[model samples]
Target: MAAAARLAVAGHRVTVYERTRTYGGAVGRLERDGFAFDTGPGLLHLPAVYRDLFVKTGKEPLERCVGLTQVDPASRHVFADGTAVSLPNASRAGIVSALDTALGGGAGERWGAFLNRARDAWDRSRRPLLEEPLPADVRPFARDPYPALRTGLLRRPAVTLADVGRRELRDPRLAALLESHALAYGFDPATAPAAAAVLPYMEQTFGSWYVSGGIRALADAVYERCRARKVEFVFGTAVTGVLVEDGRAVGVELDDRETVEADHVVAGAPLPALYREQVLEWESTDEWPRHQQAVRTGRVTVCLALRGAREAGAVHRTVVHSTDREDELDSLARGRLSERPTVVVLRPDDERLRPDGDHESVTVTATVAAGGAWASGNLWGAAGGPAVEAFADRMVEAAAAAVPGLRERLLWRVVRTPADTFRETGVFQVPGPALAGAGGSLLPAANPAPPGGLYFAGGWSHPGGGLAHAGMSGALVAGLIVEGAGFRGSQ
Candidate 1:
């Protein structure tokens, strides 16, 4: 949708072909018996990205299209040892005080100092890593951008996120807190660079927000904005292949044996799917970069419908940390389910999500191996398939610490596994954080492929996954298409 809007606004005729009947690829809504749940992301961060899109495209701003509410006490953390802390949104002092009260004496001071270092990293890499198109020569960014502190001849300077946590935080709970930020996005802190510390820093500096309705409303607004800009959308239509001739993409061929020719193509579909199904016999080895084939992770979400109303002053988001971090990462690396997984519980107080004020809607999510052993058959209904259910049960049990009497809520539940995500989006694995390594393997494929006239967007492309990154991907592709290879970035 972002690509479509930008292209249309640039005075180019734009058309979007969607395989699903509805718009919003990953951000979707689930409605059952008057209960509404956001099937994808539950919270919104770095909303400035979408705000910029609306300002550039139309007369009205994003706020006019979708009602956004900042989630105060942004999120609560429940440690395995049963320590709970509610962190106020965008308030470093409040967070420090809260941590001190909940955990120990110096925990707050340690975290505050760490955030200062993280801020430096964010300032250094913000433009190059995010707003701008990746430079052709990525060797400059291959090294860590995070500023190192002199610790008086300590063993070795921290490099990865795990090292930073253990060396600086010096408390298990605080270390868990830092690592949880990476784990929530399916990145192993042990391998992810300390530069990734920008994740928590971004959230704390800016705030976390939610739509008045589910997050699907944000998608609805984006789709509506595209439509208003005269972008045409064809639903339930699948493109059979990219019509490539003489080493250039001429257009696309639809399933109905009809071909539409164009000067350029911007593909939002997964790159792997494009190669395997949409592009025929096009054996250009360099067309798809080797780093694009790196393994990606996935997510499993369980939605709960409760009969009771959400209590006032309740935490909108709660992260139940996993007891065993090593085992969790190992399980994901081996394509299996972790015995003890970190669970994120979301409880929105909005009335639109439930039948009435008397009812409540809750969502529990965990990162898992994409297309794990559970993907062979319909795990949702297979008689012998108790693994998924058992995992879901454990997630719920862990979440009980956040939501009181969770099991006794006595309501029906719906589970969406990684297999379900693959079926819906055709992307077998959910894109994880770009690893920090020598050859820029940490980043996604560049916006422009080899040669001319072919571009890529969405999570599979540059800047990687998550709601904000996906939007940036679209903007990057549009910039490349509109301004040609000479384009630098949005700036």
Candidate 2:
């Protein structure tokens, strides 16, 4: 929608073909018995990407379009050892103070020092990795940019996020705190690049935000913006193939065998292999943004509609770290269910989401493996049997640490697993923000595919997943389409 709006504003007639009846690919809401829950991301970060989009494409800005507010304490984290800390939103001093009070020692200072090094990385690769196009030669980005502290007898650098936390922070609890950020996005911190430090740095620096009605409201606003730009949306339609002629994409073939001819074709990564094969070719060499066979991760969401009102001082978001990180990760890699998985609990203090003052809505989420053994009926046997419910039980048990009297609240709960996700969307909707290490394996395909006039956008392409990165991809695709291949990103 962002790309379509921008293109429409530039006098290009735009049409969006949506396979589903509604828009907002993954950002959705579940409403049951007057209680509503955000099925996707509970919060927004680095909202400036959307702000920039609204400013460039329409008269009404993002703030005016959606009720955007910064969360006070960005998040509360509960570690395995029964330690809880609330990090204030975008306030470095407040975070340091809270961490020092909770963890004692110089944990706060150590974390601060780490953020300083992370800032160096954010400054160095902010453009090429995000604001600009992915170059054909990814060698520059393949090098990790994180300035990890020199350690060991030979002064070797930290290779991964896990190494960074253990070698630099030097505290198990603090290490868990650092790694939790990566785990939230379904990335294994042990193998994730140390350059992933930018994730926390971006959140803490820009602060976390919430849309009044849910994250879905942001999508609604974007869709409305696209509509206002005179962009036509063809819903309940699927493009079965892209028509590539003379080494250029000139149109798309619909599921009904009908073809819509166009001057350009913009594709998203989540589209089936048909669109992928037609848009870009697979090459092992220096051709950038090649398709990768990833062992993607998926999420399990449990929504609890309670009968009682929310507590007065309940935090909006809380993360309960896994008890056994290694075992949990091992199970995830092996495509087995983790007994005690890390769970994220969200209790939004919004009245509209509940039945009334006497009712509350809570959502618990956990990241699990996707499309391996899971595809072989391990996650849930066809119709969602006991295995899926048991996994939700584990998540609820973990979330109880955040929400007081969670079980006592006594309300019905709905469990949505990766099986449900695959059944509905036919994909896991996983992977996270693009990073600068791991041989550029984390980065998605670039905006402009090998076939001229064909572009890629959304979470699956350049800059990877998340709302901000997805919006950035749309902007990059728009820039490439409007200003031609030489176009750099937003100034």
Candidate 3:
């Protein structure tokens, strides 16, 4: 939508072809027989990214689309020992104090020192790297992307997140908390890039927030802005191919074989899917062959949406760790889903987001199996059906144990496996591959695929995933197209 808005503002006749009926794609909300659930992402930390979109379109301010507030106690971590710590969203001193109280002797001071270092790294990298326009080539001398680390006074922490934390802070439990948060990004702190520690650092610096009605309102606002600018929207239509002629994307062909012609096309799907299915008759082009095989995808939650409206009490968030975390991950890597799963719950009452007066919708997610084991299931019978039902039961049991009296609150529940997700949104599923790709960092550059009038925006592109990065990718693709390199000519 950002891409469409930017193009429409520039007076280009823009049209978006969405494979799903909903507009937000992966960030969309799901409604099944009166129950509503945010299908994909729920965390809303960076509001400025979306705000920039509205500002660029000359639309109403973002606050009008959805009110925003930083969440108090950004996240609550419950341990197996009945110890729970709810870290205030932005209180550095407070968090350190709490950890010290919970863990004992010198831990608080150590946490404070570590956070201070993270703050320094965040300041050094925030503007000069993240918010800046990604240069076409970051491979020159003082400007070399590799050496920019030194130029910017940023030292590459030559250790994994787990390694760094252990080396600096000698507390195993504290290391677990820090590592667990990083794990949320689908990375194992043992091998995850040290920079990933910056995630919690930033969330604490700015805070964890939620938009007024819901996060999807941000997507809706973008859609409305595009519509006002006359950008055509074709939902529920899947693009089967990119019509490429003379190495330039001319338009697209739908699954129904209906072709829509345009001088420029921007795709927001996984790049691997685009390469595998789109770009018709492109054997003569370099864009679809070699570079197309570059990406490796990762997988996330097995989400469940409860039917009807009923408030999920006290437990705003819960994480259930399985006895076999490593083994489960290994199974997922081989395309097998785990029967025993870890769960994460973002209860409906987190921000009083439930329907009024003890009534609200709830969302439950279990980090179960992904890949082939999950992909082979029957999606329609998900709610009470064996596979999904068993997982939901385990999650419910775990959650109920954490927050007493949760089981009797009975309401309908629908479990969504990766197989179910692929059917719903067509997001390719890989068991345990890297979300950041094998390259480790999301440095910006021209499309690795054959360029020539073709471009992409979304989690599949550079600076991947999360709502902020995806929105920025859309804006970047729009800017690149408007500059006239004509995709194929960029390399």
Candidate 4:
């Protein structure tokens, strides 16, 4: 959306072709007969990133377009013994006090110390790593790595996420609570990079948030802003191929066989599809193997919408630990779902999603597996299939156990596995795009092409995933397009 807005503003005649029936690639809402569901990403953090985009587009202020409400005690962590720990985001001192009261003295201190390290890491990389583009050459990282390490950016660079957690926060329970956030990156924490610790720290520091009506509001706002800028949206259109002439992107060929010409093209879809399908013509001499082998992809997310008139009381997000924390690492590494799954229920403050007296809103989730269980049609509802119903029953059982009266709230439900997600969002293993690779962080390599009119955007590009970041990436792509869009006829 940002890229389109920028291109439109620069008078480049931008046309956005979204394969999905509606816009907002993976972070939009679905409304079906009075039931509203968040089809993709539920949590909204980093509001500033979005505000910046709105500002660039000269749209109404972000607050006016999207209601920004922060989630205090971002999520409630429930234990089998009925003990609950809620991590508050308002202030670290309050969080420390609560943890100290709930657990003990050192638990709070240990958490504080860990966050202090996170603060240091955030400061160091705030500009150099997170905000700036990383050089393509790995020498800086290969050399002294401490500049990145001392701040607790990413430890044990070559080791898996589990190794880092085991070494730092040894308590298995603490580790599970800490590592549980790894699903955000679509990897098991055990296998993910240790530096991933930053995710939780950031979330805890800057509470989770929601837009006023729904997250869909964010997408709608972007779309409206784009329209104001005269950006044309070719909805329900699929770009099947990139029309490359002389080894550069010139336009796109839709599935309908119509070619849309432009000075350059930017895609928000995955890169692998772009490359493997030859969307961008590759020079015979370019090194491309590392991109193919190392840029990994994430797994599926199953979303459920249940009919309910009652809320889950106080528990919003629950990570059920089947056993002591130590066992979680072993269990996850073995490719088994945790005995107690991590469930996040968004019973919002707004009364509308839930009829005034009834509770509503949806549960968006990510579940891991050993192999192809999710891929099997039996797990998701297929034609005349009982698998989806059975799976829904199991999820309801878990929810009922965690929150009283959850079963009685039964309504219509929809389940989306990774396979389903690929079909609905069209974000699966696309070519050319890879997850961020430089040091396991989202740092961009030098432009694959130098000083050309070409540009890139979307989660498939650098700073992959997340709706806000994806929007920001689009904005970045638009800026690049502005700089090189034949203004001076360099192309």
Candidate 5:
């Protein structure tokens, strides 16, 4: 919708072909008995991307379109050892103070120093990695950006985010604090490049934001913006494949054996559907982007239609770190279900999400394997199967620390596993944002890919996923379309 709106504003007649009868792809919402919950992303980061979209496309700014709130104490982290810390929203000094008081032993200074290095990484890659088109020679971005601190005698460069954690943070709890940021995005800190530090840097710097009703509200606003710009939407019809003519994409072939001719086709669909349908293909296996791998991790969202009222002092977001980190990561790696998965608990203090002040909506989520028997089919109405239900039960248990009496207050719960994600969005995995380093192993496919006129927007494309990165991808696609080959990116 963001891309459609931008293209429409540029005087191009835009038509969005949606597979489902909705606008938002992954940014979906669930409603039951007046209780509402965001089934996709719980919060928004780098909101400036959408703010820019609204500014460029319409007279009404983002502020006027929807309500935005900066979550105070940004997020609370509950480590395995029962140590917890509340990092203030976009306040570096406050975060340092809180970490010192919570974790102790110069932990604050270490994290602060890491942030300083992370800032350098952000500065080095911001223009090329983001806010611009995917460069042809991605050599610069193929290297680590996070400046590794020299430590013990047997020192080596911090190759992964985990290395950065252990070498620098030094405390298990503090290391958990750092790794939680990466895990939230479904990145294995063990393999995610040190450039992955930019993830936390972005959230900590830009501050975590929330849409009034849910993150879904932002999608609604963007969709409305597209409609206002006269962009067309063909819902309930799937684009089976991109129609290629003379080595260039000219239009798309609908699933109904219908052909829609156009100058360009922006495929925002997941890669599995894209490749399976042969919409976009590379003759050589090496021709594909290095980072666009088969991501196995998918999210499990449990929406609790609780009976009790939300407390005035409830934190918006909380991360309950897994007690056994090794087991958790190992399970995800081997496609096995973890006994104890790290859970993210969201307890928004919004009257709109509940029937009244007496009711509250809480969302609990965790990452899990998405392939094979794990995400075979839709598990929503399966009488709460053993695997999903048991996993959800663990998630709810972990979330109880954040939302007191979580299980007791639950009037009803709806669980959306990887299968549901695959069913709804056509892919089980939730893509993380593109990052620099690991020899471009962390980067997503370029926007202006082979066989011109077929641009890949959304998470599966150049900028990767997340609300902000998805918006950036939309902007990049718009830029490529509007300016043709010379679209360097917004200045």
Candidate 6:
């Protein structure tokens, strides 16, 4: 929608071909028995990306299209030792104080010092790594941009995020907190570069936000804005292949054998899907970027609809850390379910999500391996297999720490596996955070394909995943389309 809106405002006749009958690819809403749930991305961060898109596309800004509220005390974390801390939104001092009160006296100081270093990483990488296009010579960014700290008697400096947590934070709980930031995005902290610290820094500095109804509301607003800008949308029409002529994409061929001709094609489909559908073919396997070939993770979310009213003072988001971080990461890396996986529980106080003030809507999510047994079609339905049900039960149990009387809430639940996600969005492999080493092995494929006039957008392309990054991808694609290859970035 962002790309379409921008192209339309640029005086180009834009037409969006959507396979599903929805505007948002993964961003969707599930309504059942008068309760609403956001199926993807419960929280929004780095909202300025969208704000800039709205301002550049039209006279009305993003605030006019959708209602956004900053989530205060951004999230509460519950460790395995039963220690809990509620972090304030965008307040370094408040977070330090909260950690001090909850964990110990020096715990907050350690975390504060870590954040200070993380701020340096964010400052160094924000523009080159995010706002602008991936440079042809990415070796500068392939090297870790995080600043190193001096420690007495330590010959070797800490390079990985896990190393920083163990050496600097010292406390197991603090280490878990640092690792959770990477884990939440489906990155293995042990292997993740020290630059991964930017994840927590970005969240803590910019703060987390939620649309009034749900994230789907933001998607709806983007869709409506595109419509207002006169962008044509063809829903329920699947693109089968890209029309290539003279080694360049001229248009797309749909499932119905209808060819939609265009000068350029902006493909939001997953790269794997494009290859599978024969839309894109390389001369050799080596042509594909190594980073784009990295393993991708998926999510398993369970939505609960309760009959009773939400308790007062309930935190909007709570992360229950795993008992064994190493085991969890190892299991995820091996494409297996973790025995004690980290779970994120969300309970929005908004009345729009429930039938009335008496009802409560909660969503519990855990990261899982993509395209495994868990992603099988049979496990997507309400009556999942025994193993799937057992995993859901475990996730619910973990989330019980946030919601009192969770099992007794007396309402049914909906389980959405990676298969369902793949069916809806066409991207079975959930993109993870771009890593900071191995010659750009962490990043996604470049936006511009080898074939001229063929461009890629969304999480599967450059700049990597997350709602904010996806939005930025749309902006980048638009810039490339309007200004050609010389396009630097959004002005």
Per-residue accuracy of model 2 over 123-191 as CA lDDT, tens digit each: 998998899999888888889999988999999999999999999999888889888888777787878
Residue 187 CA displacement from its true place in model 2, Å: 0.6
Q: Write the per-residue lDDT of candidate 6 for residues 21-55, one digit (tens) a residue.
A: 87898888899999999999999999998899899
Off by over 4 Å in 6: 150-154, 289-291, 371-384
Superposed model 2: Cα runs more than 4 Å off: 269-295, 372-377, 380-384
Model 4 regions more than 4 Å off: 80-82, 138-160, 276-308, 311-318, 321-339, 369-394, 427-452, 484-491
The TM-score values for the models, in the order shown, are: 0.94, 0.95, 0.80, 0.82, 0.95, 0.95
Question: Which consecutive 10 residues in model 5 have the weakest lDDT in total?
Answer: 372-381
User: What are the lDDT scores of the predictions, listed in order?
Assistant: 0.82, 0.83, 0.59, 0.56, 0.84, 0.84
Tens-place lDDT per residue, model 5, 1-491, is 87889999888988989989998999998888999999889899988999999999999999999999899989999999898888999999899999999988698999999999999999998888788888788887778878898778876778889899999889888888888888889888777888888888889998999899989889889999999999989999988777788989898888899999988778888765676546666565455444357456788889889887887788989999999999888877777678888888998888889999899988888887666323454333365478788888888888888888877888999988877787887677788888888887668888886688888888888788888889999999999998898888886
Task: State the RMSD for candidate 6.
Answer: 2.3
The TM-score of predicted model 1 comes to 0.94
Q: How many clashes in each candidate?
A: 2, 0, 10, 20, 0, 0
Reference-based lDDT, residue 291, model 5: 37
- The count of backbone overlaps in candidate 4 is 20
State the lDDT of candidate 3 residue by residue for 1-491, as single tens digits.
87888899987998888877778777667665444667666667677777788888885877777777776667776654556676777898888878877778788798777777676656655553444443455432112111112112464433556666676676656665666665555554555555555677767777777765567766788888889889998888889988878877788899899998988878777654554554444453354432212222233343343333444445455565544555544644444445544556666443334434444455656543333212333422344266555656766666554444465555556656555556664544421211222243334333333447777666656545567877767776777777654332110
**RMSDs, each prediction?**
2.5, 2.3, 5.8, 5.2, 2.3, 2.3
Greater-TM-score candidate between 4 and 6: 6
Model 1: residue 315 alpha-carbon error in angstroms: 0.8
Better of 2 and 3 by lDDT: 2
lDDT sort, best first: 5, 6, 2, 1, 3, 4
